[model samples]
Target chain A: MRVTFPHMGTMSFAMQAILENLRLEVVPPPPITNRTLMLGAKYSPECVCLPFKVNIGNFIEAIELGADTVVMGGGIGPCRFGYYAELQQEILHDLGMRVNMIVLEPPQGANGGLWSSISKLSVGQSLWHVAAASYFAWHLCKGLDGVLQSLDLMRARETVPGSCDRIWNAAQKSIGQARTYRALRMAEKEIRQELSTLSLHLHKRPLRIGLVGEIYMLLEPKVNLHLAERLGYLGVEVHRSMSVSDWVARHLVPNPRARMHTRKVHEAARPYLRGFVGGHGLETIGESVLFAEGGIDGIIQVLPLTCMPEIVAQSLLPSISQRYGVPIITLVLDEHAGEAGLQTRLEAFVDMVGARKVHRGGGVSCAK
Target chain B: MPSKIFLGLDVGSVSTKVVAIDALGHVLARSYLPTQGQPIVAIQSALREIARALPPGVPVAGVATTGSGRVMASALVGADVVKNEITAHATATLRVLPSVRTIIEIGGQDSKIILLNHGVVTDFAMNTVCAAGTGSFLDRQAHRLGVPITELGELALKAASPTRIAGRCAVFAESDMIHKQQTGHSLSDIVAGLCEALVRNYLSNVAKGKTIAGPVSFQGGVAANVGILKAFESALALPIIVPEHYDVMGALGVAYLAQPTAGQTRFRGFGVVAADCQVKGEDCDGCGNRCEVVGFRIDGRVQAYWGDRCGKYSHVNYLSVGT
Candidate 1:
């Protein structure tokens, strides 16, 4: 009865057990690199989305390791996730893999139930087995997330070479062993505490920037070019709207986002948005407006070019900039690169942001 | 002058991620999470994580964001540099493996192929219209098979004779797989066929007319699968290399980008968790493209702007048009 999760891209939060029961076994896939991506692309259909290559690659790798059962959710709606299970299963079969592929739809949906159903299957079975496994998985995810959070803080201020990597490796090891909820909680707390003692001092003059983009690229340092750490070295506090825990708390759950702010989501979205409305871009638009209100200095948008939702936003982003009078720079990506050229562009953009901030006052400020 | 740091952020339909690095392209810290429908929540969470995860005392000097949410993330983080996923992914790849000629990234919702020249991206292709071959597809398939997604690769490897199946779309693929099973094709064969079909599908879809050079890397969240790895090795007629921390490379790339930017960063301080917000979109009657316009507001301010064909609604900066 080995349970598994598909590659979540950079959404580490899914590693958590989520529900009160059913412990999860966190599978550690080989880290993503140029080679890894190539392997995925090699076998995956050229027309397929990028995630297919990576996930199929991961599935192949895991199968070779002698695992039997694979698990995943059956999603629905505009985004392609709803039907992912079928295609991937077919691909696995075509690749000659033999194992049970379980598609878990939301508890209440067109597809059969999953999480709650898994919970229901717990009836008369060993609750301890479910609880223990779920606990272990949940703790590991929590511990890892907690540790990663602190590591990001340190990276923001780190000036010396190898410091960020050193802390990250240590933190990874510390959280990997997290067993129980309490243990995870302790380990995370300790990791953060230990990280607080870096030699680099916070400069009050750090620039404040807002980060928004596609989910996977936003969080995966390997994918997003390590922008936050670079900003930290420059004495700036990086602000990004995406986070790990926030996912479990916000979108994953079956409900509309709580309207905590007075600014209603502009009625501009009349009807197409009944319910969750798919991607986070819609939500990010509102969040960017909020950042403007919060007095964040400027904005940077990062996303895959073929991405429709983001592209749609990209088409309309000028309005956001004009409305808020904020500086915005955009970068589209696929895989190939000219690092030097990109660095030059980034340098120029930062200079512009700094210049604008200076013009605003000694430091940009938003009146409370 | 003291060394400067860099920041990279990737926001996708499913998740929003952030990363930070130093001048020499070393990773500092990274965060991964589901987008939860609100980019603000994702940004706030990423920032707070940065506040806690980065080297305790160093202050960020510059920031850049990549991904669908880059502009909004840039705004939230006060980014100094804002770039797209392609540039960010390409930049970060070069930073790590200086001579990578080809890159293939497949995440939860989409897939892309990038060709690089001495670390510079020359051409690339992406698939956003299809869910037929993405991580979410694997997630869904794994669920149907009643196996954990982590074991998909292992299970795939166990096939004696991989099954040949159609994979043009999920529905078609699934029905075909079931039909093959009904015809008594060995499970192993069925799996193999399915794999081949997916490869075929990818070739015709995302990789059409794209030349793939060697020194290739298979990255993104899905690179962990061994079954797919074998398929790739066979297709490319070359060995594929998967990097450690492959799942977070985009973040790493953007984080690396943040370091070399000039002057100071514009990233906001952490601890900003946007209050839960409800956002929506409307069909803007403002011209053709009948763009179903969308916008977001937090605490009563329109922060995010999207939905336009001719950049009419996209005007973030005052265009000097007709000036």
Candidate 2:
């Protein structure tokens, strides 16, 4: 069966690896563009978050490209994401597009969990083969995240303009083409070495800003308008509060170390938010506080408009910003968001934080 | 010998403001002209007026552009510095009042509130996805009421008791104003109500959750309306300081910024006032992105390209004139 899935940053590499290893033909959805957003918005219910619209857009594009089966992750929360798959399926059906949907939901009590879901997809493959494929995919996911994390740091200090971006594009291409675990590891090492050794403005101490928000908005460059890259270009060191590997480690895998980190994050958030408001709401607050205490100059919260959890997080962020004396800016993005407006806001925000840093007697010059 | 002067242009949605400042930040010449949906024409005319006002052969030391059309203006004029209006506004306000803590800027299409601590911007918020609380809405309301926009403030100040109007949405606000008028409310009261409604909208939306501390300074095109200024004062319960060059503050601010860039400026002479410049937008169907690439042409030769998500079109040598 030909399978397709929605794009979420570099998670596609892992998804591609898993499907290709399982002897499945994978039709990767086209890179998100204006047309994708338009298609998604046209099909999606008005007022749903931007991610949903983008997902619908992906499905339509993939379907047109001969993708008959769709694989999507499922969630259980106060956030609208939990019901997206079901709603999307109905919408596609209504549009007279005949496609089979396989939802990989979080393993609950009785329904034979993720193993059975994987088994369903790997019909003729041996259990051992499936396990090996999963292991390779997981490693690739971790490798990609590592490369990206280092790239974020390198982007701010790269002496040559657009050099970091060029390296990153090359890295993504190499990693995507790497079939074996050894090749993947080699690709990761090469990219990391290139990033670390790249010519940089060593003396330029850039403003450190932490990005905390809804997972989709934080991960999707198209949705957030390449916020991290923009900030990096503005000479701000971007620290992403969440990553795909982090999500997989916490949710998909039963990693005790990941659980320990999650527990610490929850404890940090306990003083401000007691329980989960769903969809990374508590995580957003926790990360901001942590970032502030970690001596970050600023915090930027990016979320799609009409996002409930982020809206709640946004309301509480001002208090955190005030308490920690870190400047915070919440960017609410939607289809209507203009690039010019975003650029203006980002520039102003950088200026504000830079000035604040100088005011605090920090010896860093505010880069214009 | 004529002194070197710095020129700053603010190409806003409604108006284009040009200011020529000497080395000491003294305004040598200033001109304000309606953008009238043609920023290029407005910029040229404003420059022409400023050229007329300045002494003959006074060389421009540097040039800077700000406001919504900043990029376009900079491309057209070969600006030394292109900055956002927020920074420009803050710089100017701080120059006027060093101890200023709050700035309420309501422009043609957008409104912003900037909160400062010790001359550094502590926090700021701009109106998002809505123009309901901006000067354009007020201008439209004034037009519907058969009053010149400049006269709106004077008429509003004459109201005995302002009528209540909805400030949530521009459409609703207009319908509510019409309803209040049909119900026999006086024109002055309705006008006064609009000023109050817009102020309320601005506070609840753009300035939401932002602490508006004093000493407050109000500036922008709308700041010229004394009625709106009074409404802002009453709503915030603080006396607002309106600087002498309030309308041209953004241009003035950039002009001050341009002072440092003197002698190394890319100030393509005052000849740009008569240069034939045109902008054209074409949709690139090369990929799914279909970026609407905008090309800036001077004398029918494409000088620059922008608005593409990918740098491909922007980087292409569109410079060859006859190609």
Candidate 3:
């Protein structure tokens, strides 16, 4: 059976590896573009968040590319994401696209759990085989996330403007083509060495900006309008509060380190928000406080329009900013968001953060 | 003639402002003209007027561009610095009133609140995805009421008891105004009601969660409306300081920003007033992005390209023309 899934940043690489290792034919959806957004919006309900629309578009494209089975993740929360897969399946059936959808819901009571869903795709593969593939895929994802985190820091200080971006694109391409676990390790090593070789301005202390918001918006560059890259080019070091590896460790894997990190985040958010407001709303507040206390120059919350959890988080950001003396900006994006307007806001925000840092006697060497 | 002068251009949606300032920030010449949906022509005409006001051979030491059309204006005029309107407006306001703490700027299509502390912007907010609380709504209401747009403020000031109108959205505001008009409210009261409603919308929306301290300054096109100014004064309980060049503050501020780029200026001079420029848009089907790349041409040679997500088109170093 040909299997397909939506793209979420570099998560596709790890997913593709898992499917290929399981001996399933993988039809990866094309890289997200404007066409993807337009196609998704055309089919999606008017007021759904941007990620849902984009996912619809991915499914359509994949179905057209001869993918007969679609894999989607399920959630149980106040967020609309829990109902997306079921609604999307209905829409696809109405469109006369005959496709089997396997939603891997969270391993809860009476649910067949993740392994049961995987077994359906695996067909005759043994449980041992499935676990081994997952193990390799998990490690690959962890390594890739580490590379990306370092790249974020290096982008701001690169001696050459576009060198880091070039290295990143090349790394993604190689990672996609790597077949074996050893091959993946080789690619990661080469990329790490290549990144270290790129000359960077050592003395330049770039402004630090933490990005916190919805998971989809944080992970998807197209949805966020390449925000991290843009900020890096503006000579600001970007730190993402969420990543795929982090998500896996917190939710899927049973890791003490990840649990400790989650507890710390919850504790940080306690004074501002006590309960989970669904999605990443609570985490966004928690990360902002952590970043502020860490002495970051600024914080930016990126959320899609009509996002409920983020709306709740957005209301409390002003108080946090006031208390911590950290400037914060919230960008609400939708299909109608213009590139020029986003650029203007980012430029003005960077300038404000730099000026505030300078005024506060923080010697930040701003490079234009 | 001043030995070194700087030029600033603010090409907004509704108006285009140009200002030339001397080394000491004194205005050498200034002009404001309607953009009227044609920014290039408006820019050329504004520059021609400024050229006429200045000495024939006076050289512009530096040039900067601001406002919504900053990137396009920068390319068209060879701006030494391309800055956003927020910074530009703040820069100009601080230059005039060093101790100013808050700035309320309501322009044709956008409004912003900037809070400053000791000559640096501490925080700021702009209206997002909505134009309900801006000057365009007032202009539209005036047009519908059959009064000249310029006379709206004076007409509003004539009201003894202003009526109430909704200001949550432009459509709602229009319908509410129509309902009040049909219910036999005086024209002046309705107009005055609009002024107050807009101020209320601005304060609750754009300036939400912002602290407006004393020594507040009001600038931008809407600041000219005396009725709105009064509403602001009463709402905040503080006198609003309107700079002498309030309407062109963005242009004035950018001119100040261009001061440091003295010796090496990219100003194309007054000659750009006559330069033949054209912009052509074409869709690139290289990938699914289908970016609508726009090429800026001067004298039949492509000088720059923009609008592509990937740098394939924009990064091309085409030979410069008319520099």
Candidate 4:
């Protein structure tokens, strides 16, 4: 059976690896562009978040590519994202695109869980084979995240402005072509080594900014206007509060380290936000507090326009800013979020952070 | 004649502003012109006006561009820095009143509020996908009322008791204004009501959740409206400081920013007033995406291409390396 799924930053790479390993033909969606957004927006519920529209667009493209079945992740949260699978199924049916939708839900009573969804893709394959493939997918995610971390660091310090970006583009292509876990590892290693060789402006002390927001807005660079790279180019080091690896570890794999990390974050968020208000809303507050405690220069929370969960988080941000003594900028993006407008806000925020740092004798406490 | 001067261009959707400043931040010359749906022509005209008024021997040390069409203007003028309208407005306000803590800027097509702490922008909120509380709305209403936009403020001030008008969306506001008129509310009262409605919209939408304090400065094209100014004063009960060149503050701010940046002047000279700039868009069918790429031409030579999703054709100056 030909399988397909929506793209979320680099998560598609890992997903592709898993499906390919299952001996299932995977039809990846076309690269996201304005056309994709337009198509998605035209037919989508007018008030649904940007990610939902983009996902529909991806599915439409994938289905056109002969994908008979779609793989989607299920959620358990106050956020509307948890209900997206059911809604998308209905919408697809309404659009006359009848295809099997395999939703991987949280393990619970009478629910076969994520593995059951994978088992369908495995078909005649043994459980051991599926387990091996899952192992490879996990490693691939970890490796890709590690490479990304290094790329973020290098982007800030690169002597040549576009060198890291050029290398990164090549590396992404190479990694995408890697068919095996060993090949993925090799590609990752080669990219990391290549990144290390690029000259860095060692004397430069970059501002550290934490990015916290809705997962899709943070993960999809197109959605956020490549905010991380834009910040990197402006000589700021960006640390995302959410990543695919974090999601994998916390939800899919659920290792002890990931569980502890989640607990710690939950503790950090307890004072400002007690529980998940849905779709990383609590985590956004938690990460802001944590980043402020870690002496991050500033925090930026990006959310799609009309995002309900983020609206809740956005309201609480002012108090969080006052309590933590950290400057935070909330950017709400829609189709009309002009590039000039976004850039201006970022530049002004950076200027304020820098001026504040200088005013505070260039000490880390300025961010506090 | 000054040894060094900086040029700042604020290219907005409805208008273009040009400002020339000396090293000490003294405005040497300034020009405001309607963009009229042709940014290139408007920019050239504004620059030509400023150039004509400038002293012959003065040299522009650097150039900066701002506003909605900043990138296009920057490419046209070879700008040293391209800034957003928020920064430009804040910078200009701070230059005039260092103690100013808040800025209420209603421009031609957009409205924004910038909150400042110790002369640094702490927070800001801007109107999104709405033009209910901006200059363009007022301009359109003025046209519909058969009155010149320049007389709108004075007309609003003459009102004894302003009528109530909904200030939610442009469509709603227009319909509400017509209803007020049909109900026999005086023209001045309706105009004043419109101003009050715009201010209300600004407060509820653009400046929502913002802790507005004293020493507030109102600037932008709409700041020239005494009606809007009075509405702001009554709404907040705070003394508002309007700079001398309130309408051209964005241009002034960008000029100030460009002054300190170390660079050779990229101001392609005032001769560009006559240079023909054209943009041509064509669909690139290299892939399934079929990106509509636009090429910017200056003096009949293609200078840059943009709008391609992938940099395969456009070669985007900014990098999108990571997924």
Candidate 5:
């Protein structure tokens, strides 16, 4: 059975297998774009951010393409993503789209319930088999991500631009053809060996940029202009504060009793807490402040236009900046964005961060 | 050391408020006034009022600004700490109630319900896209119904068999209220129905899945409507406690955040009150986004700017300005 999925950040393969293992057809959603934005705008409230519009468009498109099932992940927190499934469901229903949805709660919340998920998965297969399949899928995806990242580093160093793309395309083709993890592992080695043979220059000039803003934008490279890639291409190692794993960690293990700092973060954010505090923008502020105190080189606050929560954080950031003496660039994105404009600002921000490093005598605090 | 005075200003779309506190965080004086379109003029007016009420020769220490128009005014006044309404609101709630579990703030154009678990905001939601469940909606409807906004609470109290109105949006709700009136529904009942619909819309829209526990307080301009208060109580199956400064809670929250003392003064000098302030937005042709870059200038000098796709504006230019 043919299957499709939305181009989720770092979750393309795992979702494929999860659905396939469940004996369901996988239909991939279309990539985010202006057309998608228009569709969401046409259907959604004009007040929602661009990402919400994009996702709704993705779901709508996928559903129209005969994709009957959808999977989304988020926790009940400051980010609007937590309410996305609910709202998207409503939108889809209003649009007369019939589809099944899987809303995965962060596994690391106060009540970590992995067993229940396993039970749900085991409905279509044996518990051992389902668990094995999930593990295999998870590892395969991680393995692909690790290899892709390394290849990317090599590709960026190549004197020739498209030459690296050639190798990457070849490697991706090989990995996609692999049916088993063993096969995938073998393909990874071959791809790495070939990538190493290409004239490659690798240096350790990592830009410890503290990314603060919307969760989806941070993770979904397509939406954030593939910022991590762009930074890496500029010979900078990117350190993103968000990941699906971290999302689960924060959601299930929210304010763990064992960690004093976790408790502190919860308390520090309590006063500003509201249902759907509407954005994870403050996560960026908290991280930026943390990064600053820890001596990170620079902070990037990325968010969508008209985003209320990030706007709140933006208003609060100056104090955090003043407190830590860290230089931060807060970027507000919207549909009218152009690559040339983005690249210029990114180049300027990077140059500024680099110059500031020299000014600070290269003292970047790399503490978590 | 010279005595220090701290100031906090909250410039909302509806009103401008300022509070002066001595070094020990004791409020020395406070003033509030309608913003009336020109925030710069309103702020100066507020400052003049505060200055008139304040004792003479009180050296200023530090100043803070909060609210939607805060970024503009904070830069104008060189505020030391420019914060959001949420943080400011939390600060005020904690200072007063200390153990407030929830805060129901219904402002002029928007409404929010913040839920706290042990002084931490665990869950919160805001309604900004529509004015259906906000104080402004009530005001407009009151004007349309030929009832004074101030007497809305009493009018609602008299609404027997409250008329049912679908308050999902202000326009629809108003039309529905009119339709119900045409059907010969009692005005008091209709008013009460409107109140219920507003409360219900707020709950479903903003407070969904949020367990607003007891010790909850209602602040902001709309809290002044007793009909809405009773509606909230009836809807939540619990009573809502209205704060003393209900009408000026946003400003009050900033006061709590300012927490000024005798020596910390970040005021750009009251001299700025008279500075020619021009705030406007321009559509950036830099990208397809065409972001409306809001530029805040004083005396032709760009003090702060924001609303750009990249950090093209907020950065570089805001060296002296807070975010």
Candidate 6:
């Protein structure tokens, strides 16, 4: 069967690798652009967040390209994100596009777990092949995250604009071409070396900013207008508050070693927010307080417009900013967000942070 | 070898302003004109006016552009610094009132509330996707009442008791004004009521959740209206300081920012006003999203491109001819 799925930044590459390793035909969704948003908005509920619309667009486009089965990630309670897969299936069926769906939900007590979904996806594959494929895919995921972390650090200091992006594209291509876990490690090593030795002058002490908020908006560059790269261009270092690999470990891996950092973050978040209001709501508060205590220059919170959990977080952030003596800016993004307006706000925020840095006797340092 | 000056241009949807300043940020010359839907022509006229007023042969060391049309103005003039209107307005306000914490700027097409602490902007909010409380809506109401925009404030001040009108949106406000007028409400009271409605709208929408402190300064094209000023004072219970150069403050603020703290300027010279220029818009068919990219050409050669999402056409080597 030909399988397909929606795009979520570099996560798509890992998904592609897993299915292909299973000896299944895979069709990756097209890169999101204005067309994707426009087509998706046409058929979606008016008030749904941007990611929901984009997912529908991906499914429709994938169906058109001969993909019969759609694989989607699953979430538990509170946030509307958990309902996306079922709602999308209904929408597609109503539109006369019949496609099979498989949700890779984490093992709940009665749900029979990841093994059932894996068994279904592996279909006619051998047990050893499935185990090997899963191992390779997980390593590839970790390797890609490592490469991305290195690129984020280097992109801020690169002397030439868009150089890191070029290197990153090449790295993605090489990583995709790797057929085995060992080859994936080799590709990661090569790319890491190239990225480290890029003949660009590094900024001595760049202004560091913490990025936090909704998972899809943070991971998907297209959705956020390449925000991390844009901040890097302005000579600011970025520390993302969350990553998909960390989420996978906490929710799907079922290993004690994988959850230490998230557990600590949850404990730290308890003082300000006691319970999880929804998707990443508690984490947003926790990370901001952590970044403030960590002496990061500023924090930027990005939330999809009308997102319930993030809306809760957005309201609480101001008090956190006040109590912690750290500056925070919350950007609520919808399809109607203007590029010029967004750029102006980001530029002004950076200027404010830079000024504050100088005021605190912290000029650009060569401490790295 | 004479000491140099800097130039700042604020090109808005309804008006264009120019200010020239010396090294110490003293305003040397200034001009304000209606944009009239042609930003290029408006910019050229403002530059010409400033040029005529400048002391003979005093070189402009640097130039800055701000406002919604900043990109177009920058491409036209080769600006040394391009800033957003918020920064420009805040800079101008701080210089005029050093202790100022809140700046209420209501321009022709938009309005903004800037909150500053110790002369640094801490927070700001601009009216998003709405025109209920901006200058254009007031202008439209003025025109419908057969009174020129310039005299709107005076007419509003003459009312003894103003009528109450809905201020949620422009459409609702306009219809409410007409209903009051048809039901035997005087022109002055209706005008006064319109002013109050705009102030209500501005307070609820733009200034919502903002900690507006004392020492407030109001500036913009709309600041010239005494009625709106009175409405704001009564609504917020704070006296607002309107600067002498309130209308051209954005240009003035950008001039302060454009002045070189060190190093030479990248000023393109006053001669750019007379250069042959043209802008062309074309649809890019590189992908399914056919973005209408605009190309700015000087002397029949493309200088820069804009409006393309993917940067495909814009990033192409244009200077190499056959490339």
Q: All candidates' lDDT scores?
A: 0.61, 0.87, 0.88, 0.83, 0.68, 0.82
> So what's the TM-score on candidate 4?
0.92
The regions of model 6 sitting more than 4 angstroms off are A106-110, A113-120, A126-132, A255-258, A362-368, B1-3, B108-110, B127-132, B136-201, B261-263, B280-295, B305-323
Q: Candidate 6, residues A112-196: lDDT per residue as tens digits?
A: 7567777889998887898788667777777777777777777778765556877777777888667786788788888878887
- B1-323 in candidate 6: lDDT tens per residue? 23778899999989999999888778889999999999888998999999998888777788999988887798788777888888888888877777888999999988989888755677777775566879889889889999999999999999999999899999999999989999999999999999999999999888877778988899998898999999999999987899989999889988888875324665667887787889999878765346679998777877777776544554453323221
Per-model TM-score versus the true fold: 0.48, 0.94, 0.94, 0.92, 0.54, 0.89
Model 2, position B141: C-alpha lDDT score: 85
Better of 4 and 6 by DockQ: 4
**Candidate 4 CA-lDDT value:** 0.83
Find the candidate with the highest lDDT and give its number. 3
Among all windows of 10 consecutive residues in model 6 chain B, the one with the lowest summed lDDT is B314-323
Top DockQ model: 3
- Candidate 5, Cα interface RMSD: 14.4
Q: What are the RMSD figures for all models against the true structure? A: 23.2, 3.0, 2.6, 3.6, 14.5, 4.2
Write model 1 residue lDDT over A90-125, tens digit each, in one string. Answer: 877887877567776754365436645565435455
B20-81 per-residue lDDT for model 2 (tens digits): 99888888889999999999999999999999989998788899999989989988888888
Model 2 docking category? acceptable
lDDT string, candidate 4, B1-323, tens digits: 67788999999999999999988889999999999999999999998899899999777789999998987898788788888787888788887778889989889888888887766677777776567778888999999999899999999999999999999988998999999899899999999999999999999988877889989999989988999999999999999999899999999999988987745776788888888899889989765446578788898987666766445544444333111
Worst 10 residues of 5 chain A by lDDT: A359-368
Which stretches of model 1 miss by more than 4 angstroms?
A: A1-4, A9-27, A106-112, A116-143, A150-154, A159-161, A233-235, A253-277, A337-342, A362-368, B1-323
Query: Comparing 1 and 6 by DockQ, which wins?
Result: 6
Over the stretch A1-368, how does candidate 2's per-residue lDDT look in tens digits?
89999999878888989999988999999989888999999999998999999999999999999999999888787998989999999999999999888888777433666677778789999999998887888888887787778778877897666677777677877776687978987887788778767999989899899999999999988788888888887888989998998998987788999988888888888878989898999999999988988999999998988999988988899889889999999998999898888999998999888888897895543322
Q: Model 5: per-residue lDDT, tens digit, B20-47?
A: 7666556677777778787889999888
CAPRI level of candidate 5: incorrect
Candidate 5 lDDT for residue B174 = 85
